[model samples]
Target: MKHCGKGVFLRPMSCDIKGVENLSVGDGTLIPKGCTFYCTRAELRIGKKVIFGPKPTIITGDHRIDIVGKHIIDVTDAEKLPDQDAPVVIEDGCWIGANVTILKGVTIGKGSVIAAGAVVTRSCDPYSIIGGIPAKLIKMRFTPEQIKEHEKILNER
Candidate 1:
């Protein structure tokens, strides 16, 4: 689906995007095929110049497994578990690799790289590189000097 100067390449088997009103994909963004974007009761805001690899899942729903597991005998309610419903914000200039799963209430900071197949459970810091199952910070995108220069330019603006 094309929207607002952005190109979204959605696969035929892509998961349904709920809460379309609350989801925003910015300009010059690309969402590859076979990805799942769930915007359930929370906003999903994607900034400009973002790229999503194939089969990526951005989920905005987290449940209490301990409480739900005990008394939720109903099979239907099992999948309908309650979530925190906080928004998932992916800021500008991000490259999200294939098969990544971003959980609820997480903010992926600007200019960061999320490696392929990483499961992001918490928030990420800007200009950082994250990988692995829980998404550890591997390194910063810029050196200290470069970061200072960048910040100086921003301060002037």
Candidate 2:
């Protein structure tokens, strides 16, 4: 593990992470090649046993889009529009597929599977199978009985 000032780069797999001080990753998380996380003004929390495929991008900030004809990059520091920034939370045991882009203020629930090339822009229930652009819920990972049992166990904790 290489520690660069305030940022801690976990060994074995490298990632491009902005605002590393606002990021926290759980143990046994496997971040494969070409994974990027951009966190600004908010904390990005990733839980344990999470697996990320190649070229997954998790961003927590979006530029404003109120000014007409003016590019977002050009309007810097001047009062134009408010930026949308929120924390991203990825719960434990998630299998995020290749080239998935997770946007701001999204909370991926535990034991969920996100399909390849999906764009996730919202929160999800636990054990969900999400896919496609904007990332709709395809199905639940567990059966009704299994979900009940899981919820029972979680309630005890």
lDDT of each: 0.79, 0.82
In model 1, state the lDDT of residue 91.
92
Off by over 4 Å in 2: 1-14, 68-70, 77-83, 148-157
Error of 1 at 80 (Å): 9.3
The sequence of per-residue lDDT tens digits that candidate 1 reaches over residues 36-152 is 888767788888788887888887865544564565343343455456677899997799999999988999998889999999999998888999998999999998799788868
Q: Please give the lDDT score at residue 81 for candidate 2.
A: 38
Task: Quote model 1's TM-score.
Answer: 0.77
Candidate 1 ranges beyond 4 A from true positions: 1-15, 64-83, 148-157
Ten-residue stretch with the least lDDT total in model 2: 1-10
lDDT of 1 at 26: 83
Who wins the lDDT comparison?
Answer: 2
Q: Candidate 2 lDDT, tens digit per residue, 28-141?
A: 777776788898676788887788888889998877767788887876544433347788999988999999999989999998999999999999998999999989999999
